[model samples]
Target: MTHHAYADRRSGSRTHADGRPPAPPPLPVAARRGPAGRRLLTGLFLVGLVASVLPWWLDTPAGSLTDATATTTAAGQITGLLAGYLLLVQVLMMSRLPVLERVVGGERIAAWHRDLGVTLLVAVLAHTAFILVGYGGLTGRSPWDQAGVMLREYQDLVSAFAAAGLLVLVGLTSVRAVRRALPYELWHATHLAGYAVLLLGFAHQFSNGTQLFRPGPVRTGWIVCYGLVVAALVWGRLVGPLTVNLRHRLRVADVVAESPDTVSIYLTGVRLDRLALLGGQFFRWRFLTRGCWWQSHPFSVSAAANGRWLRLTVKVVGAYTGDLRDLEPGVRVWAVGPSGTFTAAHRVRDRALLIAGGSGITPLRAMLEELPPGAALIYRARTPADVLLHRELDWLAQARGVRIWYVVGSRNDPGPRQVMSPDGLRRLVPDVARRDVYLCGPPGLVEQSRRLLRRIGVPRRQIHVGTFEL
Candidate 1:
């Protein structure tokens, strides 16, 4: 249908003469757990940092830093401690732990992991450099010579160096330019080396560190930290998925094309009514097809959980997603989650404005079923042919009292620009500043919409963004 047709239809229906719907219901009681959860996690992180440095602070006398060599050595020890602690924290962030996913959300966790990764790399490199320089100064040898001596004489030093090398490799690939150049599978495989890096560096800490070389409370505490991290990894990464898959026993029920490039995969399983899921959450799906069994990819449910089946709409952008178009009925599927916080439960206001670009409409479409009446959607696509599920969106608009606008044009076109601008948005939804805005799209569109929304006086906390860029 043409854009004008949609606007005319809306005007004749539930909308008033001015083409605007009635005011949205008052803001609901917002979820209060998120702030408390953040505070608790922050406090625990601070406590961990203090505990990491406590051994050094207690063992070293006030006059111990009497010389440059002594200070450098101390710095190396401290950095080592911090690096080890942070590595554990980083692993936990991506471990798929339900508590972290629930409290912090996947998008924020991914952001924290990425920003902290740079700090971890710097700490590791600094520890290596400081130790070499400090030891060399004390022994009247070059730093290079000291490095060679440590590698030859110290236990696990070889593995530590290897771990450092692997870390450097991971960091290099994680650069935006390099990561985009690499295939998803290749990047994912390389990223898993983080676990190996942790394992390889483990013995060096207890075997050679000044504070942990001998048995003590500090050493025991460090060991417990390792144990806890291991437990979290085992449960979140392995046991949790295993339990979900065994219980659901999901299989591909059907696959239907939504557009030339998009297909919806319907999944049926045992006892689906018992599966606890939110509308906008996603899963890491591993199809047990011969060629696709080894890798899993994250996709959001394209429809709300309806107790009978689940659906995931995917755009065939790569080899893996393209392969999904050929998936046959009854193929077994292994899925990892009901993860993310893009659902109504996380909203800070009763009314919401969802802005979607291209395939980013997938999650927002599912969320429309669950949000209260009188929400609005602005879907931006380059062409009319690129718009997916407009017929369903139209039905949803009437059934749920939603106001949807299909903004189709090139980014530089005046129509799209004017509709997405701060003034234009306010004209369409005058109470936009009082509603939660859910923004999902390509990175560029999301960034631009975010800037426009902020300019129109939407509070940052009310602007919830959905991203799957872990």
Candidate 2:
């Protein structure tokens, strides 16, 4: 391979659909939910209660239902609260991310964020199930048996069907493998339907809920909270986009062939502080005229807080990354994010594990520079030639308390030492379970290390694996 191509030691990649490789995968999930999750949950529960109870308190007669007695009314109210609880939890986990990002570093925050996402998905699914059952019981029809009244042109029934469709879409993306199968560009567009889903959920709660007749102090409180959260989401989606388009601007400064397939770009952007970015968070960087901005490529800041300079390490893999090695510096770029919550500084327990595969080492390098003490680093690359900045890494390890374990995949003429597999990890560190493990590598290697750690008794929480595609 040419030195330029060989210089960029990105990950192994297959030829993309368009006959070029894309950007290699990025660091895994971010750490979300510290004090933020709890607060949002509390706020949402209140709002849901009020949304449900207001109609009842307002002295409005119960709508066209035969069983409008206090028991049924109470049941509906309980259903709304439970359903609202789920919504609140989901929003809490996704929103107010600034606070959560502070608690944990950016990369693993994203992974945990996705994991918690599954939690929210389950909540929505269960809430939907409960609503269907409750409404069906009232109508004397099975929840799944929607043939009769749904055809009657009732506004409420029509709303129910719409809500059902949206729920189905959300549920479809909940599965892990299915999610990976979908094109990310399409997935994001589909994900935005969440706003519509929220709207439908609120409308359903408002028009059909028995609690709206409630003339209570608590009902008023719920109304205020629900309105606030919805308003915030609208601002986030709408205003957030406008701001990205205008305020936080990025311009590509340089593209260097660090390894054959792997390249690095330096970004000079305005409003770094305004971005409210934590170190390990990533962005959906689109070179606009070149790469897929609409598609949103997620790349972590290899080294951020450069005041105005942000570095992104890339490895060619597909449509987005194919031409990265050829790009010149100083090109204007538009990117969105600072998303995901994966990083250190949150784990009060000092000891840690930092695993890096090729360019995935970028974010962890920044993390180590920021807080180098009390951590063990496992840097793995295909061959010894692939290890970039080895001397610098070694110097840092000696200065700071970072223990280094370099696993060169190809080590011929070995002196009775091996560094390629999980067995190498076991030999290098006997106490893997006791420390907080931080891994940043290809999915395959990360998964292998994770399984080994688990088998050896590392708790899931302690094994901070970076798996977010960004």
Question: Best by TM-score, which number?
Answer: 1
Q: Candidate 2: lDDT over CA atoms? A: 0.60
**lDDT of each prediction vs. the true structure?**
0.85, 0.60
Can you write out model 1's per-residue Cα lDDT over 186-260, one digit (the tens) per residue? 998999999999899999998988998889888998999999998999999999999999999999877777777
TM-score of 1: 0.92
lDDT tens per residue, model 2, 24-124: 22232233434455456447556754655444445545653455443444554554555554554445444534434344434444455566555545555
For candidate 1, give the lDDT.
0.85
